[model samples]
Target: MPMLKYLIIILNDASVSFCHYESAKTGKKEAGMISYDNLNKAVAFALKNNLKVNFLYPRFRPGKKYEKLIEDVEHVKIVPRKLGGVYSDAITVLEAGDLRKENKVTGTENIILRLSSPELKILPAAVKEIARKGGRINLVIKDVENFGDSKISEYRKLLAEISGLLIKKSGENSIPEVNFLTDRLMLESMNNCDAGITHLTVAPDGRLYLCPAFYYESGENSIGEIRNEINIKNRQLLELKYSPVCRICDAYQCRRCVFLNWKLTGELNTPSRQQCRMSHAEREASGNMLEELKKKNFKGAKGIEIKKLGYDDPFEIAVKNRYSIQEFKNFNS
Candidate 1:
């Protein structure tokens, strides 16, 4: 239950969407939705579970009372640059930027710049700027479900370009690692989105969500009530071992989101087309980055070895009897 070190604390009238995930759905905006009681309880839960809390805030400011409660613990607040001066010391800064605008601010240190794929082309220079800013950028596809075979070629080219930029930057005597490509390069095992396996979300309404995405999509999506008891049916199904494709897939940096799995495959553990493709795209980019970095003699990549696989998606390899999956090996330990 305390497997995840990071827990998102939703503290907003309109929760700020992170670079990679959209939390709130509809146009619901009303500040102070999370009652003080819930705040204290969440804080208590995080302490009891030893999870690091990350708070997502609304566009508007919070009352002093709310601010005091949020500061009681170490946490992260997702806020917009439009609401600048809200907190200079924000644990993680998220910007609501178009692909180009996201590019402009990509260099901010320790910031999450969210952008869609189509917008990426408009700001071809954003990747370079991101390298310049020494920031970590995560590319979030606004409409990942819309991805198709038609886009694969373009996506690969984009990844190659991003890989080139990362390689070029790493040669410049500084670290400007971008999540889409660089993360996988430095990672050895599959680093997937561990939603039900490691962490669970406590919505504003006190229901348990797999992650922030489910809470916003449909309130009917409540898995259970945390206050009552931890009652997620077939909880093992949420773990990686249960996922046929993902367990064997080394596209290790993929989010492998449970919600996206449920949406596409009608199962929590199984991944959808778009999710796998998006992840594989990133994985391939990372692979290329690893090779490019080798060419440039990057040092952080020392002693890290990314396995070479002939296939992009694990599904393909498994379908062809290439390899088997063993899920119990969570390497976080």
Candidate 2:
């Protein structure tokens, strides 16, 4: 079994989501908090496994007891912007609508901006606004599963615009770290959301899930109880080596989200057309940005190159480059 390095403890069923998945609205009356016993067990489990914990919070402040237990270990707090006043040091999550409202950004806070495809137009401006405030933004396209050709084109165009801004910032030596664009430039290998491979989630019921999305989508999809052995069915399918296109492709920073994979392609190892296209758009933009930065003689642009690809979607090339049985085995080896 792969060593589990991180544990995402969902403090409540209504915990604010920080990724592509949607959680119950914070103000919802129906909420389920993780039992104190389960939370204790989870903490113990983390200590035993030497795992880093990330506590996902809801709108309401956790009681002193819960807060005390959380502080017992080193952990990251992921909370909604509304709770920012309470957990001032936490990584904040903001919806697209929230961007219009005045909010305090400490210039050091790592912010996650969750927006849909139609909201892609808001990103370049949002990036500039956040960067001006000295804050870093990581964008999550919440509706990536719905990215058709039209939306993909819009996303690609917006990325080009953002790339131009990033290139300018690079020249000024103030390049802001936007995940999709900058992350790819820095990474040389796949740095995906390896849920079930590198990390797992502890839901309100104290069940182990591949991620919070699996728990929200269906409880039956859970790997096992937190106290028991994690038993992810067809576990190898979750690894990079098992993903044919992903293994060969170089969109290094793509989340390669398994939840989105299972939702859109119905196969954990098979990436959807939407995901491939979206990631490639970002990849192409990153390449352009790198070239611009190199021309400006940016210090960090040395030795990094995102090669241009003939096709935006790896699926196009993957189909023609199918591996034989022995070749597949050797690749995995």
Candidate 3:
């Protein structure tokens, strides 16, 4: 049996976004206290499974009763550090204010900054300050479903503006890494969000979910009780091979989100055209960013060669590759 090595438990209403893109409107009620009975039970489950647990927090205060439980467990909180004192890698909820003044992130923490179309265009300024902080930055686009061929050119131009800053750092021997345009260049294979494959999430109700959003979007989607045994149907569908667009895709940086897949396509296995094109634009941007660095005599990253791809969507190429999508599933199975 394949064992789950990581477990995520949500404790509050306003959990941290971490490195993932969070939906602006999550239809969840306030983060109520799970009976200490349940919290202890969940921790015991993690201890028995040999899993690492990361706890999620809300903006509202956690009662004193919950403090000792927090101290006892090994978990990370995702909250907005700038609002006051709540810390532990704040999720940059929006990009509306002075990038540096609004977010003077300490040098040793991680940040998840979410941006819409207009906000992303102004990312060059934020990227420079973030790189100077000596911490990692992940840029999450809010409206990927809106990206199409008409907007592809605009996205590429924005990447050029950001890449110019990144390439200049090469001269300084600085590794200013940005998720949208740089991560793909360095990843050896797929770094997709391992939703149902490797880990599971436990909601405040003490039920297991594929990830947080699934638990919040519709309560009925909960997988199973986390204490005794866990069960899932169509488990293979969560793997890369079952995804037609992602299986043939080389944009290893894309999340290939399972919840987003269900939301857009109604089928967990199918990927939307918008998602594929947006990721391809990102992949192409990284390719161009690499070319800019090479002019300054910047060598390659690791052993992975990021070959320039001709088309943005791999499904288009899958039509031409002798090994169709059917063959991919066969090999993985």
Model 1's alpha-carbon lDDT is: 0.66
Q: Rank by TM-score, descending? A: 2, 1, 3
For model 2, residues 1-333, the per-residue Cα lDDT tens digits are 356798999999889998888886644433488888899999988888888899999988778898899988779999887787676668888886777676434323579888888777778888887667666788898898788988888888899898888776664444778998988877777888898888999999888999999999999988888764677789999998898878778898799999989998898888999999999999999898888887787767456789989999898887898867777777641
**lDDT agreement of model 2 with the native:** 0.83
TM-score of 2: 0.94
Cα error of candidate 2 at position 193, Å: 0.4
Candidate 1 Cα deviation (angstroms), residue 291: 2.2
| TM-scores, one per candidate | 0.86, 0.94, 0.86
Model 1 scores a TM of 0.86
Query: Which residue runs does candidate 1 get wrong by more than 4 Å?
Result: 19-32, 91-103, 172-174, 322-333
> What ordering of candidates by lDDT runs from best to worst?
2, 3, 1
lDDT of model 3 at position 208: 85
* Model 1: worst 10 consecutive residues (lDDT sum): 324-333
lDDT by residue (tens digit), candidate 1, 64-158: 88888778777766665545455776634443443334435532456655656566574346567666766666655666676787676688888
Better of 1 and 2 by TM-score: 2
lDDT by residue (tens digit), candidate 3, 81-155: 443355443343433343546554443335666766766655777778767766567877767777777777788
